[model samples]
Target chain A: MDLHVEGVKKVYGDGPTARLALDETSFTVESGQFISIVGPSGCGKSTLLMMMAGLLKPTAGGIRLGSTPISGPPPGVAVVFQDYGRSLFPWMTVGKNLSMAAAADKLPKAEVARRVDEALTAVDLAGTQALYPWQMSGGMQQRVAIARALVVEPTVMLMDEPLAAVDAQTRADLEDLVLALRDRYDMTVAMVTHDIDEAVYVADRVIVLAAHPGRLIADIPVDLGRRDQLTTKAEPEFVKRRAEVFTLVRRPAATSSAGSDAELDGRPSELKA
Target chain B: MPDPSGATSTLTSAPPPPPAGDKAPTTRVPRRKRPFGRRLVSGVSSLWLLVAIAILWQVVATLSPTLYFPPLSKIFVQFGQDWFTGDPSSLFLSQHFFDAALPSLRRLAQGWGLALVVGIPVGILLGRSAVAAAMYFPFIRFWLAEPKSAIIPVAVQIFGIADSMNVFLIFVGTVGLIIVNTADGVAGVDRMTLQTARSLRISPFTLYRRVLVPAAMPGILTGVRVSIGVALILMVISELYATTAGVGYEILLNQQSFKFLQMWSAFLLIGVISVLLNVVLELIEKRVLRWQRREGLSGQ
Candidate 1:
């Protein structure tokens, strides 16, 4: 689905003490595109994602899934939350958890089982049907969460830093798995993360966000060619693009603002305008 | 495959040199098994602690020769002679044990049945609805603290000196606890779980049935166990104060007649029954909450 978030703003608390979490944040994810959002801590990245997922209502402005005008949770959208431990019900086994999503959607029994098996197999956890979530390792548990989302066959997948808790090696492996699944399912995925390298590695386009009333600061296409674990990070272009993105993020707004003001007043170019 | 002896010989003779990063091969002794003597001593010591208490009780009884403080041996002898013999005329069987005990058990069952029927649904409603909780909770708390046994006189006045008065008082005593616990259990379901269910568009009935009830079961069971003890206490107290039959009546009757041994037996019977009830409830709780055991520990 073509997800469009138009001038989305979220304010917490009330009256004079009200704090802006997102300031007129807007973005668009075309159908079947993989987008990653990166930002500093407390940047309202999660708030923005939750708005897009229709989990949290924005204080002002609105979101749309192909002009449907998002209100509450959209029908063809599924979310994979950060805490895998809290996401799945402790009382349920893997099979039961997957089946619950399907059952909620009122899918037929045979179809639910088939989709569950396919989703589990896609995540390389095919034979763990009866295992409870607590019985699995962190990575495996997250895979089960991903499988829960995939079983619904959602058009839009909103992942909130899904691999943040896993070890480095497992995070990389899971990132690859996400990429492979995106290709296989032809899914439109919007992921929020803090890791710059992770944002570049997984996303086709990376949107860098700023904190203190979070707003879009940089939207750069990750043009690193033929991405993989080995070649992706090793490429010279990857290093240059990363440095450029970092520079753009760290640019001093106060000094740059004075220069922009000078240029706006039609000052000569030689005066550091 | 190398033979067992050959493998050992190779291991000893080869003595592979340690790698640059390797530390010295320190021998680790397998944990020594506790000798049978030590194990036996520990086991016997635990038993002795309990036996010592029993002996102390016997010593106290033997020293005091008071009517109220009968020796444990004399009580046991009276219990065997009166209750164990086939003859229905025995004091333990005929007058004290059956005539008094069976009626009390029957009254407890009746009163507890009434409490469960009224308390459970009310508890569930109060738990789920804030408005209901606000309306009923203060009243329940007030009644719980009002010394319900004090109402036995009023109950007798209202229902007359009949089984009805006793059962009514027992219900009044026990029902408040069940209601409060049930409400608490229902309220204790995780907020996120409820949110997930709501996000999934689960119907209200299904949410209650599938998520709320199961989540609150441990709390509900706790309430039930607590109510059982209350029920037992109420049953005996009501019978002792004003009743013709039941175990409590037997105790009161024996005390009046100065049949101290018979009174003691009645108290013993009540204690045994209460413990048995508690044990059965605990077994049931373990079975019902098996899934919760590991989670409860890890959560703590």
Candidate 2:
């Protein structure tokens, strides 16, 4: 199952008020790869991910899952929203959240139950089914959110800045948890994030996006294998790539539109890939 | 693990041990397991002020033979005589109880129940749509301003000396609270949650049942609780205006006859009903909103 965002553009309003959020963005996410869409605030990183998830419509062009054009949320695609506080139903127990996410497919009782248990187990939250989301720590709540996504048994999982809210330690732990779950499920995942270190750390490929009418500037392949918090980060190649993406991300956006276009288009030829 | 007295103590507080069959769990949720009996004892101890007031009222009313302020002893006697003259088969409830108190209770229940049934959906509609809110909100405000006293007499002209009139008046009195609160609650559900529901591909029906309604429940329940007082007030006033069989009518009747003891008893019954309803509502809220209270309690 492949995802293609072909010539996607987003405009917020009309006439004088119209603001271009994304411009002529095109990219393809191959099956089962973890891609991180990373950039600063006002960058359309989240906007791109939302379009890919079929939660938002592109003003022009289209997003497609396999051969089918994404008009609405396609089956077997799920989103893990960033704000854990605003994601899960506060009134529902953890198990209910997961099961309810799956209830849309109208799976048989046993099958829905199985998916619920399996999803929780994937996040190491199996025994926490009975607890309401608010009963858990912030980190635990995010895990529940991940489990909720997993319950859909998605072929593709789109996450929008999922770790932006948690503490440093929780963020690191969750980063690894997401990777482990990705490997275990063999699901294609696109995570939208702001941290350069995190974007390079977890992604199979880091898709660099620049702010102000966000568009892709560079697509770097990450070759590091079996990454961990310490040594993988310390590797020469890892440091080089991290520094490359960091510098590219940290470079000040041009004040003028013409200036930004020249500076922002790092590799326009590779963007449509 | 089902402890009938709402005891969580018997449920182990220990984190469900990380399963050996899988990777160890990372994030942990701390579960509190306080003894229910201890909680009950401590909770009961806080009612000393209420007891003190009751005792003081009894002593003061006994000493002063005021016409309006009858002694507690005499009021109790009147209550028993007016309410308990029925045979054992009828639970010893009197005919007067059936004529007044019971009718008041029934009208309150109907009007409030109808308002809830009508109000919640309308509230949800208003909450979900700015167009609906904009259209209906001012109308709701205007109607809310006109008190039950004006509503009952005017409405009686149309519905005419009927329980429906009383019920309709109560509904008019309380529906605004429910609608406003419910709309607020529904509107309060954040953007991400709605987005999550869409991403999960939740069907429209399931979205309302699982996401929209539950998310707005705290607001809905708050609205429900706020309206109880309004509903009670409207119930009595509705009876007072029209030809009716209710405690409001009886209170007027007893007052005109100068049966001050019975009037006091009627007022006492209203107080008891109000207290009982609040208590019942709190109990229901504790159960219905167990998730909400659980978080609040965990902080304590």
lDDT by residue for model 2 (A1-273), tens: 999989888877766566777777788999998999887777788888888888888888898899999998889988888888778888887878888887778899899888887777666566677777766667778878998998878899999999998878778868877887787778999999999899988998998877766777778899888778867889987899899898778776554232335543322222221
Looking at the true structure's interface, with contacts defined as alpha carbon pairs within 8 Å between chains A and B, what fraction does model 1 recover? 0.07
Looking at model 1, residue A115 earns an lDDT score of 93
lDDT of 1 by residue, B55-161 (tens): 88779989877889688777777766555555545533544456667788778888888998999888999999999999989999999898878998899999998
A1-273, model 1: which lDDT tens digit per residue?
699988788887766566777767677899988889887776689999989888789988899999899998777788888888777776677888787767668888899999997787667666577766666667777888998888888888889999998878778778877877777667899999887788888887888776654667777887764467877898887787677667655655332222213322111223121
Instruction: Give the range of the ten consecutive residues with the poorest summed lDDT in model 2 chain B.
Output: B2-11
Candidate 1 deviant stretches above 4 angstroms: A224-226, A244-273, B1-50, B59-66, B73-103, B113-121, B129-132, B185-188, B295-300
In candidate 2, which residue pairs clash?
Answer: none
Minimum summed lDDT over a 10-residue window in model 1 chain B is located at B17-26
Error of 2 at B149 (Å): 1.3
Q: What fraction of the real A-B contacts shows up in model 2?
A: 0.43
Per-prediction DockQ, in order?
0.12, 0.36
